[model samples]
Target: MTKRQRFLQRTRSRLFSKGAPDYILLALVVILVLFGLVMVYDASVIVASETYGDQFRFLKLQTVWVLVGAAAFAFTYLFDYHNYPKLIVPAIVTTIVLLVLVVFAGPLVFGSRRWFSIGVVNIQPSELAKLTFTVYLACWLAKQKQRSGNLKEAFTQHLKTELLPFAFILFTICFLIIVEPDLGTTAVVAFTALAVYFISGTDALHTLGSFFIIAVMGVLGVLAAIISPYRASRVSTFLETIKSGYAPDPWISGYQINQVLIAIGSGGLFGIGFGESRQKFFYLVGNSAFTDTIFAVYAEEFGFVGDVVLVLAFLMFVSRGLRIARNAHDRLGSLLATGITVWIGLQAFLNIAANIALGPLTGIPLPFFSYGGSSMVVVLAGVGILLNVSKSSEKAVFR
Candidate 1:
């Protein structure tokens, strides 16, 4: 039979197979995207008005991206996710080209050359890099596993073949991002790659050895940052404030964090009311309210109750994502789900914690809620993949 006939046969078998529908996860994704839209509008109004001379500018752009992202989500849902393996090489090549292009062709933003400006909007290649790398690695590793039967075959050659290439890719990407000076994103991608490596079951010893190398690389990364006067100053400022009781100057390194604190603290038990944020009035400034410190803007406008509801929504997403991973039909599917869950969940935790002063200001946005096209698009696409996996699950896909 031709490939098209085989595809039709498989599709019919899958459609008539004994498995639950995947609407539940799809619905949850829609809910999160909608929630993000509401929060983005609330957080970005002032920034947009001040920066772009229109209150609805950021909101309009975000709406467009969300719409495009949702369409991508639906496209993936209708397509077979197992076919991801077929697209891996092209995706990786595309990602690498973008990454390289960003270095030479992209415009600088916030002292980092991370975005590729296309007329009206800016696209961050690093965001797409995460999903692309995850899918490629998972696909490659799974095939390696299938070829390895006994422990000895797996140990002697399979692990080396599978892991070394991943390590090289991770290091190269990490180096480029660090050069871009997007420390937070580089860290996230590096760690996510490590998670995939660990899940691939590439020998405990190899995994542990990789951990050691990564730790050394991390230390060197810190040294590199220290060598840069500006970065060194930030680190010093971060440490100095810890040692001295003197309040941090709002004009310096502490400015962003202070604004974040004021926004959250001013809200108290009840928020300042919708669109009544005092901080947004030449206080928070620029895209701060929309991206890195969105939770602060949210807290200021929605109060404690709103915060709780948002957290609950995230908790629900996490639970459902984990469920999808657990019931995945195969190891590749399981690893893909788990990696995405960790990426979104950990990033969310980091963003929330940074806003509340639980950690240093990492300049990373809350996933789904932040005002960025690449993140919204790629994250939704990931959710689409998760839904595809859910569709293939033995349990009810709709439930």
Candidate 2:
């Protein structure tokens, strides 16, 4: 064969050798995003018109963010996954600086300084923190394993020398996030970090110890909420609604959840038809129709069938992610993939649970389905890294 032909043959072999990126995973993401865009428009049109005199105002902004997220996804997907470990330090530093900046100089929206207003875009540093911390922890744990080996002495020594520092950093980040009074984001970040730690082959004793620390922190969080009347009222309201099966004052304390239930119930089985939700017509107050309670609007429009499909989509996404982690090329890849998966999956669960009043009202956004630019961009970027990890998986190559 000619030299050029031989070179082309080798290139084809190499390109085809790893199979293709997880197309099923990619397809599920695309369906969710496209459906999200439609639902965002459906849920926000009236609110946008009332606030901005344009029905498509939020829709136009969300479209821009979706484009930005797509660009982010492409960049991360094509980039080498192994390079992330090397960049972990810089990523953590940037997260810290941004978190500090948001606390000191960021604009306070709704009495919390969680976002920095950057011209037309508002950046949430906490969102980026979740991704960065996962990368950092995964890299650190992987390196420790390499240095220490699997001997019990080595594991103990590593914990003595490394675990304290890791715990301190984790605690600091969690403290900073909770001080933003965003307990929801704090919970997601902590859960993601702990998941990465657990999957890194930490010993059972250490795992139990870590869980104890987490439980204590959780209790403190509940106490903190109860101490604040505004927050305590939310908890009590949720409890009352649960016990009574209805809110006493739909226009007052339990407004959002009540409206969400109404939207969900009004759909019966098949939904009220797309963009035909009655709750979005000023019946649901605040940002329920668009952000916090978008799922309710979606259910109201598409019904139980749509809800089932959405749940299955998320389940498939998680299944694909876990499979990628199991077949990842190395420990770091596996842990990073696992961390990203847990973050997305747990956050989605919390959002949906809160809407259904299965948990206290915490303003956690549904992953791809929520209408928030910062969340959409960060999550899509994480998905890009996940896809890159899948590309590097030995099992993925054959499949």
Candidate 3:
């Protein structure tokens, strides 16, 4: 058999493995999902009732998603993550096809082509990319081996074997996503993949090269935002607000962030109390009180103490995930653990930062806390995969 076929044969031989799951990791995910459901209902009740004539519309829809996410979590948690290499190619193709289809066939919403309308459900291809592309990168990186210790030969070998293919795939996937004008998701995917690649080995050249590529992509994203009319307006608003202290048109241009600040500011020591946020009524961006800005409404209801608790929960979750990565049984498991952990951690940080004005509004979900079925399902699936990796950690490590 050929070297390629041999690699597949040897790698695929370990089809499955079993071990005790990380209960701490499991507990953190459970807490977040349950808390998210409660907040979805609390934040979405007013608008859901007004538009759908049912205060429980979003809550009910979210509950259905939670159930779907549970099944996805269970499947990924039990399945061997080492078997990912056998399926990575097909997964890559599906991810690309879905991304292209969404851009062409999906309805445009708010000037961006990001999701498909499937009979009372919206699936964001960009979100799916977050999971699939990570799997692709982890599998690819796990297979890479240094050709020769000779620095010159090694550099050239790395370029030919790793960097070239990586750049091509990275640019292609990112091109499709940037066309959707979804920079937030693109950044998360790009950085997560880069982390997996860098963690796969300690090649200084590869690390620097990957960082350079992502930096170039970041520059391109900035240029794209500057050129688009709607995105330009956002850039201008962000600059105007940060430089001075207000937007030119407070009620129109700066409304969302203004409302976010208002909600956060009014939520003093103990907050106005649960479900008692006045901003959730009509002050925030109508229905978005439940989506991109849910954190603001959460802050309004729970106060500073609540914010500290939530932040600490996320910190602990990330710490445990990294520990799992450090103790993974194999290269694939370690990189897989790293990729999943970084993806979720970075997305959560971006969402929270945007809410608090630490960064410009990126319209990304707060993982489990956001009220989107696709997002909830995708995130939980990733968590499930992380948990799967944890099962293979150094004997009873986190058990």
Quick one: ranking by TM-score, best first? 3, 2, 1
Candidate 2 lDDT: 0.82
lDDT of 3 by residue, 4-116 (tens): 99988755443222366677778888999999999999999999888889999999999999999999998888888878899889988999999999889989888898889
Best first by lDDT, ranked: 3, 2, 1
Candidate 2 structure quality by residue, lDDT tens digits, 248-343: 677788887888899999888999999899999988776668887898998898899988888888888899999989989888789889999999
> Which ten-residue region of model 1 has the weakest summed lDDT?
238-247
Q: Where does candidate 3 clash, by residue pair?
A: none
Which candidate wins on TM-score? 3
For 179-276, candidate 1 gives per-residue lDDT tens digits of 66666677677777777667767556567647765885687468548544555555555565556632267687777777888899898888989878
Better of 1 and 3 by lDDT: 3
C-alpha lDDT score of every prediction, in listed order: 0.75, 0.82, 0.84
TM-score, per-candidate, Cα-based: 0.87, 0.90, 0.92
**Colliding pairs, model 2:** none
Q: Which stretches of candidate 3 lie over 4 Å from their true place?
A: 1-18, 395-399
Candidate 1 matches the true fold with a TM-score of: 0.87
Backbone clash count, each prediction separately? 6, 0, 0
